[model samples]
Target: MFRILIVEDDEVITKALCKQIETWGYIGKGIHDFNHVLDEFNEFDPHLVLMDITLPFYNGYYWCTEIRKTSKVPLIFISSASDNMNIIMAMNMGGDDFVAKPFDLNVLIAKVQALLRRTYDFSTVQNNLEVHGAVLNLNDTTLNYENQKIDLTKNEVRILSTLMENSNRFVSRDEMMQALWETDEFIDDNTLTVNVARLRKKLEEAGLENFIITKKGIGYRIAE
Candidate 1:
C-alpha cells in the first residue's frame, strides 16, 4: 500500500486529513514531533508527503529541502499561505504541487492520486530504513547519519541491510550468510567476519559507535 505522511500541526486538520486519506485506501500518518520532522519522514519512508507551510520549529520549505536531498518522492504543500510568492517558493523548494487551505477533500485526493500516478508510473519507490537516526537508502545503498553520507560496498550494503532489517533482534550467522549469498559472491565464514568488521568501522567513523552489537556464538543486531 502507498503511504502518505502529513506534516501539519493542527490536530483537527491532521486527523481529518488522515481520515480522508485512509478512506481512499492509502495509509496516512501525521507528524507529532515538529522538531524532528525529518526523523519522522525517514522512519515512515512514505511514498508521498503532504506538508504544511506554517509549522512549529522549522517551516515546510526547510523540511522539503532536506527531504529533497535524498528522495524524489512526490510532495504537495497544503497551507493557508496561498499567495503567489509562497506557491512559487514551494515549487522552487522541491514540492511537486501546492494545495491551498480550505481545499475540497475530493480535489485534494484527486491531486494526490494524480501525482502518485505520474511519479510511480515509470519508477518504483524504494524506502529507506532508519534506525537510531541513521538512514540506509535502499535505492542507492548509502548510509546517512548526522548529515554525513557514507558509501558502502556491495557486501557492506547487504550486511547492513540484513542487520537493520532485523534491528534489535539477533540475526544468526547462517542467516546473514544466506543474505550475502544472494549476491552470488563466494562468501565464506571468514569473509563474513571481515565484511562485518569493515562495516562496523565505517559506522564508527560516522560516529555510530556500538551501532552493531555481537553476542559470542550467536550473531549480530543493531543496538537497541
Candidate 2:
C-alpha cells in the first residue's frame, strides 16, 4: 500500500484529503508541524506528497527542493494559487502535478493514481552518504552512527547533502546558500554560520568529532 503525506494547512482540507486518500486503499498522513514539516515527512516516509504553495516559515517550493535532495518521491501541489506563474513555479520546484483548489475530487484522484504508478513502478535502492562510520540516510534525513539515529532538520539535511555530494572537496558558503535558498529572499551570512554551528554540534554529540571540517577561509568538507 502506498502512503501519501498531506502538507496542507487547512484543517478541513487536510482531514478531507486524508479521508479520500484512505478511501483509495492508501494510507494518508497529515503534517501537524508547519515549522518542521520535514520532520513529519521523515516520520511518515510517504510515497507521494500533497503540498500547498504558501506555508508558514517557508513555502512549498522550499520543501519540495528539500525533499528532492534525498528522494525522487513524487509531489503534487494542491493550492488555491492556480495562476500560470504559480503552476510553472510548482513544476520548476519539482512538483509532479498541480491541482487547483475548487478542483474535482475525481480528477485529483486520477492524477494521484497516475503519479504513483509512474514513480514507484520501477524504483531503485535509496542512497546514503557515509563518512567516518556515520551514515546519512538521504530518504529520511537521519544520520546513523554507533546505533544512534540523529534526526536532521531540513537545513541540516541540505548542508550535509551538499558537503557529502562533494566529499573531500570544499563547498563554499555561497554555493551552500544557493542550494538552501532557491527563492529570491535574501539570507544573512550569519544564518549560514548558525546552521553550520548547529550541524557541527550535532555531529560532535553523535561521536563523529570533526566530521565536517572548516577549510580556513574557503568553506567546509568531509574528509575521505
- Best of the candidates, lDDT: 1
Residue-by-residue lDDT tens digits, candidate 2, 1-224: 99999998888888888888889999988888899988889888899999998888899999999998877678999999999999999988888789999778778989999887644442234468887778888666689999999988667887887898788689998898986774223556798899899999998998888888888789888966
Each prediction's TM-score versus the true structure: 0.56, 0.55
State the lDDT at 34 in candidate 2: 92
Q: For each predicted model, how many residue pairs clash, with residues at least 3 apart or on different chains?
A: 0, 0
Report each candidate's C-alpha RMSD, comma-separated, in the order given.
13.0, 9.6
lDDT (Cα, tens digit) per residue for candidate 1, span 117-155:
755542354467789999988655689999999988668
